[model samples]
Target: MRLLSREIKLCSVLVFLFLFSLKVLAQPPAHDPSKIMRDGDRYWTFKTELGIGAISASNNDFSDWQSEPSVFGDTWPSWINTYVPDFAGHFWAPACIFLNGKYYLYYSCSTMGSHVSAIGLATSPSLNNPDWTDQGMVVYSDGNNTATVSNAIDPAIFKDDDGKAWMTYGSWFGGISIVELDTLTGKTVGEKTTLVGGNHQDIEASFLLKHDDYYYLFVNRGLCCRGVESTYYIQVGRASSVTGPYDGWRTFLQTNGRYIGPGHIGYNEGRLTYHVYDRDDDGTAKMMNTTLDWSDGWPVAVEVTQDPPGELLPDGTYRIQSFDSTKIVGVANNSPYEGANVEILDFSDDNINGTSWVINNVNLHQYQIAPKNYINLGLDVYNCVGDDDANIGLWSYWGGQCQKWIFVDMGNKNYQIRSALSNKPIQVNGTFESGTNIVQMSNNSNDTTQLFTLVLLELEDTTYNQYPQVVSYSSQQSGNPASNIIDGNNSDGYRWSAENFPQYVVIDYGDTLSISGTKIWTYQNRAYQYTVEFDTDIDFSDPYIVDRRTNTSAGQPITDNFEPVAARYARLTVTGAYDYTGPWVSITEFEIIEEEIVGADELTLNDNTKIYPNPVVDVLNIQLPAELSSGADLAIYNMMGQLVFRKTGLKGNIELMNLSNLKKGIYSLIITNNKTFVTKRFVKY
Candidate 1:
């Protein structure tokens, strides 16, 4: 029955165009992964073999990874051969913990499937510094009496809430076992006791996590190291005490479609990291990450899809209600065009058109908000300004900083919607009223005026380009050349830093292209003031100030956007750090964003609309169908669906619109009336 059920589940997954495969990305191969560790701004996870391979990611994003030099780097500690005479350089299932201002890394040493194994320890002052001091064998098994002893492999360390430390180590030989460890010396302190799988069940790689009142034990079951054929899955059990007769073990994670052999669970900050056989990639072992949803007492991994374009929110229809519960966000007079004032209004069951909004998730926790009345227009900060009390309004959705909002969850289904431009939440001008204006202001967490609740009404899917190519880059600092900013590594040793104030870095795309925004991965999480400028030519004769930020408290990878502009060069000038008083400026990585281009096939429109002079410079003529001529409205939006031009109450089939001041780019012309709606694509040169 179990085998039949597994086959049926696999068949169902194949019918959905392999939606489960969407969660997998091109990641470096990793096996027996260590618990993810954080060093300053980077995340590190060690793997088995290849000298204890160390892999890292920047800004806490595990989707993409970069490999650092291995810890041993071909030099093995001489003491390993003393235990297992034929011991190779390969170490397995490393567990790392930071304690007392130092890091202790424990690794398993032995040949494959051998009971004559030993666990060794290495200490380092810092992860960035490769000065690992080898501490000889912590524990070992002779295996001379094979049937009576447990194999010393896959060591996992757990520190209880009482500050007492314990080590759990073993494999399939005689079952999993646990022993107390001295936190000061990283060594065993008491005798070992067998826990589970007494010489019968195929179990290994055990890990323990304490949450609330339970100590949950996680272990791998079934065969491993067989590539695509491996059946390794994660099983978990829980107990009330640190050491106990645990409850019945149940499957926690198993193979899903192309993600086969999910094993070696490592957790950090409510997120789980493991390795899986990627059937799609020739069964290669790859690292996988997911957030843990503990709402149901037990932890369940939540599948995270690929990041949306920039910081757009997930595609959905929602009701945005203020914390007062009586008020919701609405457009003034139900207007559906640019510059329409957004305000808080009394909730009404029949006011769906005024209260409901369409939100598109881009990346991280940020989203682009559009009203249901006109999904083409987005919620905007007036004039793209980040000043306090900046009025919030409705504008064309152009993927600009003014339209993106970060939803900060404040518990109880309440959130603080902060503007990506100003890093402030929309608050009532003074007090809540029937038509109180909403303006961006500094956050006061306790203020009810700034909190909102989003009730999801519908769901949709959208994709975006996360990172565009950077052909070349230059910076003002020579000591740490700006070239490091585009080197594809965000580790501490590969950052661009300058001790001088007003330092700058320039990224050149090698060709003039439509760019919407850029994000900076700063050296550290300190507040920095900076200015961004864009230009088509290398010379600054006609530069456009895209964004100028000051007094910001945003964390690493600070993101900002501007209206889509045709430029080949972008410059970031660091004015100062930490209230503009610090002298040094550092940056690890700089990403340039390309404007999002939603294809015409993605839109539903009448097929009769026509436009001429696609690459128009001064004037654009539109030949609309007779049905849409009179009493109709026309709106011109950029590639990102941001409204650039609009007119109402049209009266004729032939409408001539002048776009002389518009920049060169692709745009969509949308014409609508009470009954007919159509959209046509054009270009402005």
Candidate 2:
């Protein structure tokens, strides 16, 4: 009898396991999941997992959710499967909203390669105990006589800042589209709007959200299936209005480290959540989340710290600077160690791999600083010529003991540095004195010797575009002065009246400059067409056309990048306006820009001194052919000309200027004995 009871218990357990599996399968599918909507404190959403039908779910705490009936409810009485024959049994995308005590669910009923598709809606009173009632078809595209030009899939809704309702939909068949919608009926109104279309229609799965004054459009690009092989990811563009001619698409979520297929996502409160396939976990698509920070008013994903896997520092290249010595460390090009020498020199502005370090965190507060060029070859820090005061250079990054570094945050964005290679902290060895070679020593005296700060290096054009010798311009109308355009002010844009055709402004860059482009700012969306030209003379003799743009609609200040040319004179010609009133042209601010060529910018000399390895790594060897007084002064200045490192009473023939503590980049090195002094350029790797 006991054996019989045991068998019954095992059978019961097996039955429960089967039921649990079914419940998990019944939840909304991962591909193109619906954006969650809030019903008081409870949340509700829909998904395209069920074919030709949409699935529903609700949760009060967001941790646990219970699946509800199909969004079409009781029975899908429509012949949607007939139109979407290829994908007859499945829905593509779904979106939900809670408005006026009614939960409205919208979904795309479509098939592969068939233009005959439709977006339909359903209404429910209570999302938790949903009894969805069909609201009939909202929009459809048959690709027949005068039917919709869009594919009628991937629906997203946007409620404008002013409380107006709009819907965005469509897929590969045509392009992502938008249309105004009635708030009361949840049905589209007004003329169908073609937001984007044609061969550039390599996008789908649209999602929209309004933050601050901008409306952000998120879309999925590339293929969606194949698990680990899926190339799918999310991209975004933003505009000031719900109906938009969005700008270039930027990767909303970048792939590479851990996740993949970050598509068909949603937003809630401050966090953006999306379903992603884990490349390391055999492509099991799961929900992933991230917070955002504003970059010049645009959203950039910020990684949060989680234990175990790789914990990365903020991504970007940097120049490691020592707080004590204030010099940068580098691989010596002048007095190189046997393979790649170690030395210290004044900081430089140029990004040289041997000097520039690519610091990536292995875990929180721990990182591996690799040379930029070496990183490309998969080389990291290794005790290459292994020994005490070993030859440290780039080598393949495996799980080696010497590669790990611990950055001790010493308040105010500074750090007290230590390494996993040795128990001693990294000190600007006085061998330990001023201008001393940096070496890792046993825990000795505590001073500023081991302190360091990572300095950010500008990657943009470093070549300064001369601010023009004279502000020269012309205009036909009154009230607006021609100087306003070249005044370099945006307080109020330049305006004109009693318009002039072929309105033009001439710019004299003071001296000859290699013209590349110009930054034009104007009254919002007024400049429809404009042209830029460069020449050596104002007559435009040997005129070189820089760039011309027609139908310019973007309100943001326009950036026109062109091939660099040598010219001292550039001209701006306004040809037309989109919404022109009478014959008038208004120019706000026009500025000339120059190409930042690698070798064109020479270091300004404050004096003259000889320093070897123009771009030095470790030691900035200074050898004066002449004798110097026992009491001599030497100093290093950064690009900003700020004094960073200095030494007094230096009496020597050759000074081994220890720069291992300075940030990598260009710097002005100065030396003086008696009344004689010299300043010259030096670089730290």
Candidate 3:
């Protein structure tokens, strides 16, 4: 009878184990919705609680959305210390870009009206599920020098055709500045250059776009974030070169009402245009223009104008036959007049020929009623670049060298305006106050000097039939010829190539071996699978049997440690790879070293004990020491710290009841038994 009872007991235990395994597999996986955005396509939005002031998207539209973290019930990272606890007093003006298959997000932190702000970088593999790796303080503003605010904000990155990287940024402090960047090392290569000055209404938030042959400079003018009194608006100028003397000879201005602000420009498909900025009366929430058009070299707010084709006159000019205008409601057009009238004009001696035009009675300058009646010649206004001592004057004529600017459309509201003379554009210099003088200079093309902003203007009847001209500059190869190898060179397999890595190498071993030393060697113009052989004989055929590494494309030597291996013939094999013309695995000499071996099992945990309720249905009893007092408390935490259970006044044991409501998973328990606190990890089955 005793033997039969034992068999029955073992069977019952087996049955319970089977049921528990089934329950564990039945639960669904957790869902993470934090990275999803409203736009269903190639866009995403993630909430960052670094400072909690404002949240701006990588898309560069800065009108609406309070973007505060506290309002969204988000908290800052726990690692932040008490010194700058409010996270440097709020994060504002963020920028992001994708480089080498990683997403780099840059942000600014500082208080209002202070140049103590700093720019930081965080990296992730994907916009969703972004494991933000914080790269602290790439640049900081100087607190001293009242005349020049050193606040470093608004970072923009541009990669030239030659693979060289540049960053442009700046605001209120000094004007805009640019710095050449070493993308591989995340550092600046040379001294920074002051591109544009803060003079002539150049304020916060600047962007650059390369269109055709010009680098267009876009900047925010007037006041921003001032409730209903915000004078926020955008202005533009261009140059034929990256750095320049960006002439505002063809500057476009807009006016609606108290609703006047900057417009966001972007390129859909291959068309270059702008998005109208729409903000609520409170200036908190903002929207965008619904419709898009590009006939006038400027985008109108949600309205489309269609004109019929006409024949050219004897004077080599075409007349605008007819046009229709419509107002985009809810899209705040501050114009007192509800509708705009269109007309075509023929200027006899003007170089401007074969262009459509629309005349508006709106005043551009505060002094003039209608000086020259704001002409939208349908030609992009390119900023200019000239020498510091060069006469960078703006003229109305189409001839002089200073009047030339290159217009490039850099997809999303970003542009690059280059100068025809110096092949650069006009850039903002120190981050000084508004009305600081703007200057023409070389193309630093870095984010610090690139300016981005919005512009609000009425559509005019002027449309140039001829597109702006652009001059192409040849891309040149750089670096020492002996040190650097081109892509197709078969001399060195490890030479720099554009191929990306599939997976990173990881080290694993069954037993603790002294990893005192290891080294890898490669031959010229060939690839090899170099690895440290240990224990058994090296087998190159079996991928899993041998630990191996491929040559790096950076053309650098690699060596590591693998010690105390009682084996001979430490050889490297030429595995399958590209550019393998000869035996690439070459070893001049191999050395063996004797070292101490440490085992991972030698590690231990002190004063900590974990418990578990193996087939528990409801209550769980935690065994404690007899020295525990009645006032002792026991706190229980789930995997996510939802506080599933808690108790006080424990004697020799703690009884946790009413646990039938709990789910099956891992849990952490903290028991304070008579001043001897113990943290225990357990599982509820």
Candidate 1, position 518, lDDT? 73
Highest lDDT against the true fold, candidate = 1
Full-model lDDT for every candidate:
0.68, 0.55, 0.36
Q: On TM-score, who's better, 1 or 3?
A: 1
Kindly give the number of clashing pairs for every candidate: 10, 31, 110
Query: Which digits, one per residue and each the tens of the lDDT, describe model 3 over residues 1-685?
Result: 0000001100000000011121111111100001112222233322223332223233322222223232113343333322233343345555555677776666555544445556666666755444667766677665555224434766666666667777666764466666776776555678676566432113445556565566666555444443232344556667776666665322233323222343323322222222222222223212231233333343333432211111111111122211111111110111122122111222232412222222211111110011122221211122322344232222222212233343333334333333333334434434333322234455454533333221223322221211111111001112211111111223343232211111012111211223345543334423444444343111111121234444443232334554244321222222334445432223222233435323211112113232436335577766554434356676765432235577887764445455677765444566554324545554455
Which tens-of-lDDT digit does each residue in 105-218 have in candidate 1? 998887755678899999888887658988889999886654346678888888898888888877765778888888889999978877776432356889988889988888
Model 3 — TM-score against the truth? Answer: 0.35
- Comparison by lDDT, 1 against 3, better one: 1
Model 3 residue 12 lDDT? Answer: 8
**Local error of candidate 3 at 397, Å?**
38
Model 3: residues with Cα > 4 Å off, grouped in runs: 1-41, 45-89, 146-150, 199-202, 249-253, 263-280, 289-685
Off by over 4 Å in 2: 1-29, 51-61, 72-75, 143-148, 269-271, 289-295, 300-685
Candidate 2 CA-lDDT value: 0.55
- Best candidate according to TM-score: 2
